[model samples]
Target: MLLADVVATSAALAATRSRKSKIAALAELLTRAGPGELPAVVAFLTGQPTQGRIGAGWRTLAELGAAPAGAPELTVAQVDAALGEVASASGSGSAQRRTVALRGLFARATQDEQRFLFRLLTGELRQGALEGVMVDAIATAAAVPGEVVRRAFMLSGRLPVTASAAVTGGERALGEFRLALGRPIRPMLASPAESLEEAIAEHASAIVEYKMDGARIQVHREGDEVHVYTRTLREITGSVGELVELVRALPCRSVVLDGETLALSDDGRPRPFQETMSRFGSTRDEQVRALLLRPYFFDCLHLDGEDLLDAPLRERNNALRTVAGAHLIPGESEPGAPAEILESALEAGHEGVMVKSLDSPYAAGRRGRAWLKVKPVHTLDLVVLAAEWGHGRRTGYLSNLHLGARDPDGGPPIMVGKTFKGLTDELLAWQTKTFPELETRRDDWTVYLRPELVVEIELDGAQVSTRYPGGVALRFARVVRYRPDKQAHDADTIDAVRATLKG
Candidate 1:
């Protein structure tokens, strides 16, 4: 298949606001892909090259000012091979080599194709279609149920391979994917809950565990050999020798444990999240050893010789405790009242509690309500100072609200943060039409609007920030809803936002 065809489909997906239309366009592309081209097509549509991260970022792409080819002649195979060269280029003169290859690659692409390639390479595809939408497309093209595709994707952890199998074979081929000893699958995620009482009300007798603010890890062990992976399934076996050693010493001959890794102070309190991340992302042994990350085993997906992915949480916790005695996270199943447990978590300076259904199995890659994370929420009525032009399905609309907190000391509103999450297409259309009418000025990327639009934002808390002029920023901020009845004067004060950062 020609790269131009793939680029055209991406453009179509971006232009349409309908999810069904996006799925149809993707499915059509899947149908047209030959066996050899299926994997490359899947990767490109998902806004990535088959060779991930190719050592190039936005900075590297900025310098490659290659003119586009007058005509389309690039094939998927040819483009993928060129990216492979860029991905494999290393050491000595990789930057120069990458530039040489990227110039040739982009020079052959047309203007639209060049835009698509930039988005794909810079990890800013902005297409509403990610792996979730691609999964549906694969199912539609393969004539398989979405559940079957999701299950296979959960186990395999590689959508490209799963898509190839779905295209060539059928449900039977997808069924072949299962939990293996050394393979790392995506870890399960939890949705945020209003409060502990609310979480307990939904999951009455649930497993309430301490929700630590740290890196999520999945450890796969076989006898003495151990491999640790991050939440994104990136292998970190060599960097974290202490973590590997801890998992290796488990009582079980083989195991697959899911938990969090963090650097804890001598008082047993968790260290700052950035301190843990420092070691987690480090490649130097001394840097890693400076702040040792201890793993707290929570769920055992595999124990001894058998897989427990299909087992209930009750059984998995038992397996986890049996394998890791002191390393198990502090939690209980129907052991006490939810309020008391939450108080203990807060007193220990931890993030809140995660209430999970005792009977639910390990539902990897899905953030279902079976597991609810109860954390204190901080809501603020903030004014939208400005907004940026949207991309992909949000094409001609205004997205990414630039939120600002009111300064009651007779000053302009302080810009706190920016967020594009939780905005529906309807909201996007309304903002696009309204913001221009209220525009104070116009720039290339953002529309400088008068702070007349008030938005109610939901956030976890605030943290000291270096980026925003406010000296503090909201953490995990998302637009809950727009406050049509409220005005800019009703917005929360900057002091209120900064107060959440303490205690």
Candidate 2:
């Protein structure tokens, strides 16, 4: 297929607010894609290239003075191959080679295609082709059930791969996707709860566990080989040797364990989140050894060649107990009152309590009500839309932050409010240096940025307001931390913020 067709469909998707229209357009486009071109088509439509992060930044792209072609002759396969060359260029003079490759690619693309490629490469393509919508479109195009597509995606951990399979062999191919060892699946997510009592009341039998303020890790062990993946499914096996060793020591021959990992102080309290995250980047073996990450397994997805993903939490926990043993997270099943559990978790320097339904299966990649996370303070993962120049003691620094909530319908992030609170001197220095790099444009007072950075904000609550586009504003909002592990799409949605108004 021609690249122009994909670009035109992307424009059509961005022009409409109706999700049904977007799905229909995407489905039509998918149907036209050849079996071999399906992967690239699906990936490009989602605003991400098959070759992730080809090292081309805004500055590099801007420096490429390639003039657009008059007509569109670039094929999807041709563009994909060009990007592959660019991504593979990585030696001493790789920068120049990458520039040459990108320039050549852009020189052949028309104005419309160039614009689409630029946005797609820069992670700025926000045309509502979210994973969920894409899954639906793939199912529609392949004449398969949406649930089948979704399940395949969740298990395979790649929408493009799932799209290829669905298009080639339909539901039968999707069924081939299973819980494979050494391959990371999307971790099951939980929704934020209003309160512990409310969460407990919603489920007949609940397992209340401590909600740790740490990174999520999914460990897959096959015999002696163990692989650790982040919440986003990125492998960090080499960076976390201690975690691999711990998982390898498990009695089970093969297993997939889902849990949290963090560094702890001598007194057993969790260390600062940044300190724990630092281990993921540490290249020195001594540094990693000094700050060991402790694993707290909560769910056992697979054990002894048996898949427990379809089993209820009760059965899964039983399997987890058998394998995890001492490594299991502290939690009470069918507790009389979860209020004490919540209080104990808070006092232990943890985030709060997670109230989970005992009967729910592991619905990977979906944030359903089966698991509810209750924290003492309200926190929302919001995107940094813009930052204003500081005044007084904070002069020259980008201090006040304009935060936005993710639009669930796949539109641009909606500005909710601004806050300069909870920023330390170090944070201020970092922001001054970082925000400019991410700046899309700037005025005299404020610098607008791409909606990429995800910052966790602690607020008293939310209130109905018309000042912001989302019709809700945060109350006494302050920055808790910058969540580097999350992306803009992973930020809390506007609907979630508006729901806070009920509090």
- lDDT scores of the candidates, listed in order: 0.82, 0.90
Candidate 2 wrongly placed segments (more than 4 Å)? 285-289
The alpha-carbon lDDT assigned to residue 48 of candidate 1 equals: 76
TM-score of each predicted structure versus truth: 0.77, 0.97
TM-score of 1: 0.77
Model 2: per-residue Cα lDDT over 121-168, one tens digit each: 877788889887798899999999998888888899999999999998
Query: What is candidate 1's lDDT per residue for 11-127, written digit by digit as tens?
Result: 887787577888898999999999899999999987679998898766567679999888999999999999999999999999899989999999999988898898788655646
- 212: Cα error in model 2, Å: 0.9
Model 1 per-residue lDDT at 295: 84
